[model samples]
Target chain A: MRNIWTICRKELGGYFVSPIAYLLLTMFALIFGFFFWNILGYFVNEGMEMIMRGETVPMNLNEQIIRPLLSNVSVIGLFFIPMITMRLFAEEKRSGTIELLATSPIRDIEIILGKWLSAVILYSCLLLLTALNFGFLFLYGKPDWKPLLVGYLGLLLQGGLLLAVGTFISTLTKNQIIAGAATFGICLLLWVIEWVTGYESATWATVLAYFSVITHFDSFARGVIDSKDLVFYLTGIFLGLFATARSMESLRWRS
Target chain B: MRVLTCFLPPSAGTATVAGFDVLEQPREVKRRIGYLPETPPLYPEMATSEYLRFVGKLKGLSGGELEKRVDYVCERCFIADVKQKLLGKLSKGYRQRVGLAQAIIHNPEVLILDEPTAGLDPKQINETRDLIKSLAGDHTIVLSTHILPEVEQICEQVIIINKGKLVATDSVRNLQARTRGVESLQVEVAGRDGSLSYELVQRRLEQVPGVAHVLCRDPHEHRLIFEVQSQKGQLTRGDLARAVVESGWDLNELRAASMSLEEIFLELTGSDAPKETAELTKEMQA
Candidate 1:
């Protein structure tokens, strides 16, 4: 545990020391805030229209605004998660510090956990930035805080799963650009894997749709947390991290 | 060195350091070994002291123990002045020293250095050598370098591997002495008037007792030079000088030529097969 934390701290330091972390944070906030402002504007206008029509059913703020914002944060993460994990192992290999780590007394699992944990933490910080916008909704209106927390939890699980995949890809090469591009490609593919279910109803099609990251995330976005979706995100995270460990082990033997 | 350091696994067989099997117990092996790869493994974004502390933590040092060793190594490696400087901005010499410092920060039993002074200026190389020499009392140091003098200077027990095969393993003095079975003498002589040909001088030296071969070399100013090889355990310096003086030739220079480690390294790791190397090592041991 101590070893993992040390590596995680160093990795977090790596991110914060470079311009990449700040740039990613800023761009993500700018894009997420844009989406939030536009959605909130649309929600308020729709509520006024409902009032004007004498259909006085209270508009659901959670459904109309926060859910789409959380979903957009996941989309924004598709770009930023790749950036967060690109340098994790790639830069270490490029600069030859991987030798230092590889030859150290730490286990491969510890190193992997440390690095992946840091990526998850950085992603959390990005999610925390979106919380400021979420704060606005609470001050002006009453949305169930419980559902908002559940939505953020789902987002965290989904981001953790994808970041694990990115960590695995980062271990495959010494080039950060290749790692980043490959990670983005794989993340996008996983996001869109459910598209196959649209035209086919075969068993394999159902299986493919089941593997889509967005499919499992839909329930949580609806302000509901099912054990099935929780299991899916947890299993996805385990598999991604498992694959990363195997990649790291193979690299030791190959080199 | 990489194999011993647990960086690269061996294709076959295994190795043990400090009674720990590298393949079977890598973490245990790692705990007792300090390795410095050819390039100093450094994070450019980290300051020198911070990097040391980080490496120290990875090596399993905690709190006060880690900080004390960090300070000790920084002072020992002569990087104390640059402790706060970012590693990327530091000079190569300081970077190399920091690499060395990190390796020894944990104070492991075995210190494996791969060409530790490969790319340093003459002064820095000497300083680094002195630091390594000072470290010899506390740790069993394993240093590899293409600079023959470095091995002759710093190392005690030497292992030479050529193309991934063990060429020879012995002490520096033993390798030198083993190659001295057949001794060569550098003899420079000429007539009192500087008229004697090198060929004539070479023939005269060949006639000396115990001389196995004589080769004539170019004249050194007024003196003709001859390299005379004598059989094993022979001392023909006196005979060669007497023969030159008896022939009315002026003996300008006569000195025993010691085989340098560079020459012995080339001879051992050369095209010689493993069979010949094994035989040579066997003969040396005998």
Candidate 2:
């Protein structure tokens, strides 16, 4: 456990010092902020129009505002998570540092979990930076904290899922390009599969959508933290991380 | 970690390091056996001291223990000068020192350093060799290097492995003693019958007691060539010389053939003479 924390500290410290982390953070802020502004603007305009007709707004302002912002944050995470994760194992192997790491007493599971946790924390921090969006919504209207907390929970869940997938992808190759591309490809597939299955009426499609990380994220974005949705995201997180640990273990003996 | 006596199999029979079974207890075995591969894997972004501290921590050293070990290894490997420098900026020599320091960080019972002096200049190589020698009393170091002098100067026991097989394992003096007879012994004889004389010499030499077998020599018009191997504890050079004198042959050339570690290494590793062998011989004499 100490070994895991040591690895985590160094890996997280590395992200802090390197330009890659800052670059990804900037990209995450810009893309997420842009999507949040556009989505909130459209939703607010529609809500104001509805109010002008003398009918209660369809959704409360908090739901109208924070939901779109946090949901879009999850979407933006699909891109930035891989940027930080692609270097975890891939760059270590490429630069010959993997040998040093593998020969140490640290377990494979610890190493994978350490790097995964670092990515998750960095991704969460990026998400936290956009918290001012919720503060803005709270200032002008009555805001319910439940959905806001649910929305943040959903964002963390989605980030965890993406982090696991990205870490597993990073283990597949020493080339960062391949790691990045493979991570993006897997997350993009999960995203598209959820949308496609939603269109079809197949009962299995609903099950697939239920399992889709993006779909499970919707429950959280809507401000309701369902146990089943939480379970689905947790399953994704565990499966991805488990596979990464296995990959590292196999590699240690293979060569 | 205590090292038990064992052998590295397939290469030979059984092997153990610090009482741990390399095959059965690889983890425990690894704890005692500090291995530095041909290329030491280093995180270039890390400072030498930071990397060593991390390795020490992973090896389960306490904070204070880690600091002491790190400093000891650094000073022993002569890497203290660049402990604060990032690994990326270190020279090939310093990098090798860093490799050695990391390998010895835990003060393992045995050290296995493969080609430890590979890329270092003469000064660095001497410093490394001196360090390895200094550590001999307390640490059992298995230094694998193509440099024969490294073995001669540092290793008390030399195990020569060729083609994944143990060709010889003995003290340096004993191996040199065993191979020295065959390697030396200049036969001085003038022959007129040419091929017939060579065969006669071979047959006659084999007939001598304490003489193993005589290797046929290259055809020199006036001189016949043959290599003589003696039985254990018996040298027949005197008898052979007397035979040549009695046979009425003019003894033209006779010299004892002594081989250096470099020559022995090349011969054992299945390679011809290294280009630098000549310079090494000159250096050894100087």
Candidate 3:
């Protein structure tokens, strides 16, 4: 546990010291804010028209506006997680530092957990930037903060799962380009797997769709917090991290 | 799990270090062994001090212990001068030294260095050699290099592995002695008759007990060569010269052969088959 934390601290330091982390955060805010602004604008216009028509608006303001805003943020997250994770092991292998770490007193599992935790921390910081949207929503109207918090929770979970997958893919090759591309490919494929496969395969697709990261956003988009959705996200994160540990261990001894 | 077998397959054999089974106790093994690959592995953006502290922490050293070990390793490896420098900005020699420093940070019982002197200049090489020698009493170092003289300079017990198999493991002096007396004696005979001089000298030298083979010829003026072989702890060079004179052949010159480390290395690594004649011809020219 101590070794893992030490690795995490050093790895987190690497992210902040380099330009990559800052650039990723900037991109995260710009894209997520844009998505939030556009969605909020459309919903406000719809709500006003419903009021003018003398009709009760059916959708909850948080459900219609903030949830959709952060869900789109989760989609943007899929692209960025790989960017952050592509360097974890791929760069180490290319620079020949994998030998140093592998031969160290730390276990393979410790190294994987350390790097994964660093990405998690970076993603959390990036997610914090989207809090501006939630703050604005609170200022503009009498809106409940419950759904917004849950939506952010789902988004955080999704980011964790995606980062783990990205870090795992990074261990597949020494080339960063390949690591990045492979990570993006896996995330993109899993992201849209349900849409491409059609309804005939909806059972496995629905199960995979539940695991798609997009599906878990549903519970958070509303004011609901389901333990099943939480379990799904946790499982995804665990499997991805487990696979990463195995990948590193196998590569070291395969020589 | 502190030790694990590497390089060779686990099924073939196993080695334990500090009560760690190399296969099962790999973590414990890693904790007790400091390994430096051919290339130094380090984060470029990190300062030398920071990186060592990080590694020390990962090795489970406490705060005070980490700082102490980091400084100790840095000072021992002579890298304290560049402790504040980023690894990327440091020169190759400094980087290599930093790599060594990290390996020894945890003060493992055994240190494995693969080609530690590579890419170092003569001065740096000598400094590293001296450092490794100084570490002999405190640490068990297993360093691998193609440089034969280095083994003679530092190692008390040397093991040579070729193509993934252990070829020879013995003391430096013993290895030298095993090839001793197989060395030829070079004789430059001067002012002697050309005809009987060649034939008579060969016959007289062959009669000596330790003389396995002799080749006497007029290279410039006249030279006689003897490839001598004797049972260990047997005979002297004076006996051979006396025999030549007793045979009514003039003896003008006689000297025992000398072989450098390079020659011995080639002899040891070369084929064990009947290539002694070809190697002999090459050695004579050398």
Candidate 4:
């Protein structure tokens, strides 16, 4: 546990010292803020028109603005998670620092978890920064914070799952660009796999749709935390981390 | 080196470091060994002190001891001046020193340094060599280098590996002694009258017991230089001196030309080694 924490702290400290962390933080905040502004503007305009027509329809901020905003954050993550994760193993290998880590007394699992945890923390910090924008919504509007919390939870699980995948791909190569691109490709595929169900509702299509990240994320976006979706995200994250552990083990001999 | 350091598992064999199996008890082996790859593993963004602290922590040092060890290694490696500087901004020599400091931080039982002085200036090389020599008896240093002279000077035991196979492993003294048995003595002799006959001298020298071959070399000034090869386990110097004096020739110089580590390395590793030299290497391996 000490070894894992040592590695985690080192990796976390690494992110802050390099420009990569600030670059990622600013970019995520900017893009998410743009989506937040555009979505809220549209929601307000719709509410005003309903009021001018003197209709008694209630405004649902959670459904109208928050759901799409959370969904867009997941989409933005498809681009940024790879950038955050591509360097975990690839940079270590390229700079020959993997030798130090490999030869150290720490277990392979500890090293893997430490790096993945740091990546998660960095991504979470980005999520936390965007929470400031959510604070403004809370100050003026009465959108139930319950659904917003669930939406953020869904986004974290989905992002964590993709980060784990990116962590595995990062171990496959020493080139960070290749690792990032491969992670992006794999994440995008997971996002769009539900499209096949739209055309054909066959059994295989249903299975593919079940595998789609968006299919599970939709429930959380709508303020419902389905047990099956939670299980799916958790299991997917475990498998990704399991695959990363296997890759780390192979590195002992494959080199 | 990687296999021994617990970095990479061997394909078909098992190794132990400090009585710990690399495959079954890798953490134990790792705990006792400090490894420095050809390129030192460093993060560019880390300050030297921060990096050393991290390595010490990874090696199981904590609290005041870790802090003290970090300061000691910093002073020992001559990088105290750059302790606050980021590794990326330091020069190559300073970086190598920092790499070395990390390896010695926990003061493990074994230190594996590959090309420790590879990119350093001459002064730093000497300082690094002195530091390694200073740490010799207390720590088991497995220094891997391509510089033969460095091996000849710093190492007590030398293990020569050729094509991933053990070629020779012996004390530096013992390996250097390979220059002696069946050795060739360079003898420069001249006739007393400032003239000499190469044929006559060669004939007289070959008559000495245990002398294998006497090949005449070019005359230098007034002396005829002959490389008198001796048979295995024979020291023909006394008999040769007597024979040259009896033949009425002035013996100017007679000394064994010791073989260098480079020559021994080549003889053992070279594909085209002479028959006798190849046998010598095989004998050493045995």
Q: Of the candidates shown, which would achieve the greatest DockQ relative to the real structure?
A: 1
Question: Which residue pairs in candidate 1 have backbone atoms (N, alpha carbon, C) closer than 3 angstroms, thus clashing?
Answer: none
What's the TM-score, to 2 decimals, of chain B in model 2? 0.64
Q: What does candidate 3's lDDT look like per residue over A33-121, in tens digits? A: 78877887888799889999999948676767776777677788889988999999899989988877777767778889988999999
DockQ of 3: 0.47
Local error of candidate 3 at A160, Å?
1.5
User: lDDT (0-100) at residue A45 of candidate 3?
Assistant: 91
What pairs collide in candidate 4? none
Question: What overall lDDT, based on C-alpha atoms, would model 2 receive against the true structure?
Answer: 0.74
Model 4 stretches with alpha carbons more than 4 Å out: B119-121, B182-256, B271-286
- The list of candidate 3 runs beyond 4 A from truth reads A40-61, A196-208, B1-11, B183-258, B272-286
Q: Report the C-alpha displacement of residue B89, candidate 3, in angstroms.
A: 1.5
lDDT of 2 by residue, B137-186 (tens): 66677666666767777677777766445667777777677666554455
Q: Mind giving the per-residue lDDT tens digits that candidate 4 earns over B257-284? A: 6677878787777846432332211111
What is the TM-score (0 to 1) of candidate 4?
Answer: 0.88
| lDDT per residue (tens digit) for residues B1-286 in model 1 | 6778888787899899889888989999999988888899999988999999999999999999998999999888889999999999998888889999999999998888877888899998998889888878877787777777777777777777776678788888888888788788888776887576777777777778899998777655655777788876675577878898999988889987778877887788774544323222110110
Worst 10 residues of 4 chain A by lDDT: A58-67
- Overall lDDT per candidate, in order of appearance: 0.86, 0.74, 0.76, 0.85
- Candidate 2 C-alpha lDDT tens digits along A29-139: 787778778887897788778888988835767666777677777777787877878999998888766766665655678888889988988888898778866677777
Candidates by TM-score, descending order = 1, 4, 3, 2
- Candidate 4 residue A11 Cα shift, in angstroms, is 1.3
